[model samples]
Target: MLSANEIEQVYWLADSLGEPGQRIDDGLFLARVAMHARELPRNLRRFLADFRASNRSPACLVLGYPVDEVRMGPSPTACNRLREKTIDEIRLEIAAILISSCLGDVFGWRLQHEGSIIHDLAPRPEHEDVGLGTGSRQHINWHTEDSFHPYRADYVGLFCVRNSHRVATTIGALDPDQLSKRHRRLLSAPLFTFRPDPSYLMSKAHPLPGTDRGGILFGDPENLCLRFDQDYIDWPDDIDGIAEAVETLRRVIEASLIHMPLRSGDFLLLNNRRAVHGRPAFTPTYRGTDRWLKRINITRNLERSRRRRQSDFDRVIYV
Candidate 1:
């Protein structure tokens, strides 16, 4: 949470960026947002720097940022959301992405929201039971963001526009160091496969379904990263004790899972590499005032996905 003065400083920065006259994908528009990030409150920048340095599973929340609920239009419908966004929507994206730029290069998937860098997540009556973020009537499962792809995000930033229903997001973390050497070795083996979730499958191009296989734990031993998605894993049933191993890890995550209810003006950042997040099912009012959140995905090494990107400046990854 920011102090009153700090909150004012943050809002002032957003206000200074007049109207976002250009589309989000426009080069000049994105440059303008990143340039303005130079003026963010010093404490906020310092805190983000420290969090990045930790290189461990962590979740941080910032409250007291201004969000004009009345000014924000109703939650977007379930159709293709590639059209124009309201002024309030653009304002929040500018502020949200500004904070995100401090972490790393933000990117999106071609199969999700039409390569949207900034995503609007809200309940859509047509997709109430979907496993994606727009889900409302069904509990979204705990999983790493874009778990099926090696180019998955390193961090995920979410800014709440509104949460009239008070839905709670569940998050849990697992450190490989907590397990025995044998268990750690088992998890580190490339014995698991993950398929693309419905979010990517819904793309208009209807990309061919593909599977990705990798170890659950990788990276430096002291600052381990994880990749997990219970719904899409396809481990060999004949593998001895694989189920037990998965159950063991699941239990740890279940025990550690915590419920966080976000409200207007709250911003949540999750370590997508280590933290698994989900949301419980909730009834929606659909009164144009349903829960709404703006989301962005950040990767420390954008170049690593060059094969999947069209050009140097293109942040949208192709399958």
Candidate 2:
């Protein structure tokens, strides 16, 4: 995905940054990346172009980029404890930000993860059973990123800095032609609702209504977009018909699953509206060398989510 010269250029960009983790004027930063992006490999530019044009595939992987092994050190045990000021971390983030700029504006949810636009995804033993990425023992069930929210990201970008033991990232995607006639009709109807996942709540707070009645399948019928969370979806007991449909949809999605193991210097960008992604239960050694990934959310348009955040310029959405 990156040539030797291109990698050097990216590192230079990272070095030029005055502060790490402190949100920059992304508009200006994006402009710089846009200028340098032309110097990147042709195939990479085409891949980003195709992905931005449509949301069809589960993900696009960019491999062979450089990761400064010595500078990255060990993966942080907790995202909150570490600031992204390290040289390697900033370089990795700059790489991600540059790739994301090709797709859209990068945004973050104020109530989720660390509320940082660029966040870490490393196993935290203490949250093994929680719904967040820190859960290690329990597989994080497949779902669209921020499935409970209407203004979810258009694409989710993940940059792997370290993953010595290949841990598989699971993805489920089903074409409309694969769905049964009845199942397709039901999912297209407004019969589904999602509860706020644990990520949206405080430690002991009760679950809140996350979305109004909405269709699980949206967009063009030929290339339907998905919105689902098996663990957080709320189905009325009395509505047996919709319940059966949901179950059928789940079966089809599971049957078409694809798993990919990301290695260092690989960035996997997923179309959040087109597929659901999760991870298998993998034991983690909280030691510094544990698997670590940096993630960011991208939206096609910044104005569409202005109502959710304090201002159009703000990247974090409180709602």
Number of the top-ranking candidate, with TM-score as the measure: 1
The lowest-lDDT stretch of 10 consecutive residues in candidate 1 is 18-27
The alpha-carbon RMSD values of the candidates against the true structure, listed in the order shown, are: 1.7, 2.8
Off by over 4 Å in 2: 5-42, 81-84, 203-209
Estimate the TM-score of every prediction: 0.95, 0.89
Model 1, 197: alpha-carbon shift in Å? 0.5
Each prediction's whole-model lDDT (CA) = 0.81, 0.76
Q: Tell me the number of clashing residue pairs for each predicted model.
A: 0, 0
In angstroms, give how far residue 207 of model 2 lies from its true place.
12
Best by lDDT: 1
